[model samples]
Target: MSEQATTPQDLADDAVVLDVREQDEWDAGHAPGAVHIPLAEVPARIDELPDAEPLPVICRSGGRSGRAVQWLSAQGYDVVNVEGGMKAWEQGGKSVVSTGDKAPEVL
Candidate 1:
């Protein structure tokens, strides 16, 4: 991983994570308070990203988030790709939440 990538273990306690996974993936499971904006929607959702803080971007694995970080960085956003994304998050024993009443699991 580059300096722009961070493992779930390195995530900050209070930082808000920006989830760039698709809607179905998001509906299955995600970190509580994570912002849901699919990779395809980022161009239109740039206004929603954190402006003053370093945003942590995640996806199913690291692939999509890595792409997002590259684009977001080019636009001057201080962003970091979550190295292992949500899969690592769940495996690291971090909390996960789901839409509706479903149990949260990384799909």
Candidate 2:
């Protein structure tokens, strides 16, 4: 069955947002308080993922995060994919940040 997907605005204040994009993509910009774990590394680092409610996974777009959600859910995670991903999050004016003063943006 397809899992539920939610927009940035719909996420709860305490939700855990997981970014499954590549390292460079994550370095560019990501949602504030989001966790960065590349899709390729998820299997090996699955234990690092938060055991929390409304675990929304995201990427540049929804594709990669969607796949990650599928795998994580199968592994017994209470996860969901962020519909439209970071692009939508940025477009929706949600908070995003990078390591430095550079303006945050999706790569």
Candidate 3:
């Protein structure tokens, strides 16, 4: 299958952002408005994922999210991998939120 990747800037304002990182990683930081669904729980929680084109999946660096994009694509969910993942998102100065009062930082 062909690869589909997008940068933080390319995403639509109302895009469905799926963060596939672990629980702790998500607590540390994540794109504002993005959904928190860790990679391991994806299969079981597949129904929760939006049935939209170009669903954006992100991880700490991109490996896990890339794998998810592949699987999701095969399942007919037009998914895309967030290149460079949260690291790139942060470097791009994109807005991120955290559960804690402290400023969100990619972990």
Which pairs of residues collide in candidate 1? none
lDDT of 2 at 14: 39
* lDDT: worst 10-residue window of model 3: 7-16
Rate residue 60 of model 1 by lDDT: 89
Per-prediction count of colliding residue pairs? 0, 0, 0
Task: Tell me the tens digit of each residue's lDDT in model 2 across 1-107.
Answer: 25557777887533578989998788889887788889999999998887667688999889999999889888888888888888988888787788677887898
Quote model 3's TM-score: 0.90
lDDT of each: 0.87, 0.83, 0.85
- For model 1, give the 10-residue run with minimal summed lDDT: 6-15
On a 0 to 100 scale, what is the lDDT of residue 95 in model 1? 84
Model 1 gets an lDDT of 0.87
Better of 1 and 2 by TM-score: 1
Report the Cα RMSD per candidate.
1.3, 1.9, 2.0
What is the C-alpha lDDT profile of model 3 across 1-107, one tens digit per residue?
A: 23599887787544679999988889988888689888889989999996567788989888999999989888888888989888988888788788888778899
TM-score attained by model 1: 0.93
